[model samples]
Target: MSRRLITEVAGVIEAPVERVWPEIVRTVPRTELGEHVLAYQGGWWYRGEWSVTPVPGGTRLVHRVYDVAGQGWAVALANRLFIGFRERTRRSFAEGLVHLGNRLGCATRLT
Candidate 1:
């Protein structure tokens, strides 16, 4: 039996998806790469995905974290014990967007 817990954060970068893709690949290496998508798996329970899409002004970058655990109860318990996990995830994603914006010399806003 497997269960998934997902968390997501999105930001818009003042650049095209083409420009943002390379930076995402550079920052997050050794992942399963696809058109505007990067997938990473860690340990046996965690999967992280980064994706970009063309928006009105620029590109929308979204990060999603998933806990896909066979032992769903254990994962749930662990998450309950981990204080501020969701907040930390959001903060980290925001910081990453800021860094990526700096690298691209563009502005980024969390959505």
Candidate 2:
């Protein structure tokens, strides 16, 4: 089965679309947000990508990660064998977006 996961963050950044996309999509790790932005807690590391777009009210952030495999028999029964993992990833994205919003909002002096 093909596995897909999508998460969106709106109003996540106060900076202009031009100003935010670069940092948001940077390949390097940012200390402020921690280097393990997308690492799986007790498993092998995997690569992930993030996208940003300008929406009517704010910017939209999207994250996609792939090739995630399950550890045991439980996963065989699971639809994607990575449901919990994807959920954790979703939470991580939400947190980073919220933090990014606060940082950019402060920088932009947007109340």
- Local distance difference test, each candidate: 0.84, 0.50
Give TM-scores for every candidate, taking all chains together and pairing residue i with residue i: 0.87, 0.54
Where does candidate 2 stray beyond 4 Å?
A: 1-14, 25-45, 68-83, 106-111
Task: Estimate, for each residue in 24-46, the C-alpha lDDT of model 2 and write its tens digit.
Answer: 64643422234223322223424
Question: What's model 2's lDDT at 65?
Answer: 68
| lDDT value, candidate 1, whole model | 0.84
Spell out the clash pairs found in candidate 2: none
Best by TM-score: 1
Q: Can you write out model 1's per-residue Cα lDDT over 1-111, one digit (the tens) per residue?
A: 254657889999999999998888888854757788898877767778899999999999998888766663575677684578778989999999999999999999999
Question: Residue 10: error of model 1 in Å?
Answer: 0.3
Pairs that collide in candidate 1 are none
* Shift of residue 30 alpha carbon in model 2, Å: 11
